[model samples]
Every structure is written in structure tokens, then in C-alpha cells.
Target: MMERTALISVNDLNIDVALRQAALGDRVLDLTPKGFDLLLFLAMNRGLVFNRKQLLEKVWGYDYAGDTRTVDVHIRWLRKKIEADPGKPKRILTVRSVGYKLEG
Candidate 1:
């Protein structure tokens, strides 16, 4: 029997958590460690909005000493890789003062 792999799909984006890989159609995306973690978390949660603090703790761990703005930078990078138009993002939506959420 073939082993079934776990996958998170949001539109054209496909993430393989087990392999720690993400791809847009046939092209594999080059994601940083933090960037991949953030994407995996958001993709798993789907529509739930998570604040910077929450993201830092979840994606970067509670021991992280960096500013919450790190999340913003990662989010921006992720949008560029995933969204057809990073300027007008469709997958990762900003909740303004609240934070961000992945629209699956």
C-alpha cells in the first residue's frame, strides 16, 4: 500500500507538512524556516485570525526575543511567494489592527 501524505491546500498553493515543503502549482517555493512555520500555522488554522504575539509564540516560540514586527516581515515575504499579486494579497489577508489570517 502507498503511504498517504498529509497536505494543506489553499487554492494553487500546496504544503506538505511531513516533508516541510510548499509549492505553487508545479513550482516549489523557496521558504525560510520562519516563513514556512508561519505559513504552516496559518494554513492549518485556515480562517482564524492570529495576532503578532500569538504568531510569535506559536511560530517562533515563547522564548523568542525579537519584536512582533517580525511577523509582519514574514507575512510580507510569504505573500510575495504565494499570492499572484503580493500588492493585493488574496491568500494571506491582514486583519488590520487584529493581525492576519489565511483565506482557504
Candidate 2:
């Protein structure tokens, strides 16, 4: 198995994969299991857009039967937690008519 980095940094945010933790500066951000997974996925594949279907499959798994709207909801939740201003997100960006990607 390929070795994985224990920690990932996106801008000022810090993610510790082994502990499944996310922090910003001196504050540790509380993220739900799926929310952390979503953030990790995007942080891992920064700049690469993944449509709702792809996000659902990758994050929620192939066995998941939820609709694409689930991804939207999760993204909204994530932005609220991570973004300085959720209304104009700078990290998780929406690719119109396409998908979403993380930018640090």
C-alpha cells in the first residue's frame, strides 16, 4: 500500500487524516464523519472538479442510494464550517453546470 501523509494543509486549515480531525489556526473545526470525508476528498484532489454523482460515489460509496441533492447539502454544510463567508466561498468552489473543487 502506498504511504499516506498523516496531515494535510489547505490554506490555513489543517487536516489530520489519521485522527480524522480538521483545524483552522488555533481552533479545531468540528466536522461530521461524512463532512470530513468530503473535505478530505477535495483536499486530496484539489483543483479537480467532481460532479455530484462522482462525489456521492466517492464519498458516500457505490452502495449509497441518496440523490445528488445530498451532495449539495453536504457542500453547503461544509462551506458554513470552513469558509470565512459561506456566501462567497473561496475554498470549495462550484463549477457551474459541472461540479465542485477545492482551491487552497
**Tens digit of per-residue lDDT, candidate 1, span 1-104:** 99989999988889998899999999999999889999999999999999999999999999999888999999999999998999999899999889999998
lDDT of each: 0.94, 0.94
> What TM-score, over all chains together, does every model reach?
0.95, 0.93
Counted clashes in each candidate structure: 0, 0
Which segments of candidate 1 are over 4 A away from where they belong?
A: none
Clashing pairs in 2: none
Worst 10 residues of 2 by lDDT: 2-11
Candidate 1 whole-model C-alpha lDDT, 0 to 1: 0.94
Residue 82 error, candidate 1, Å: 0.8
RMSD of 2: 3.0
Model 1: per-residue Cα lDDT at residue 66: 85
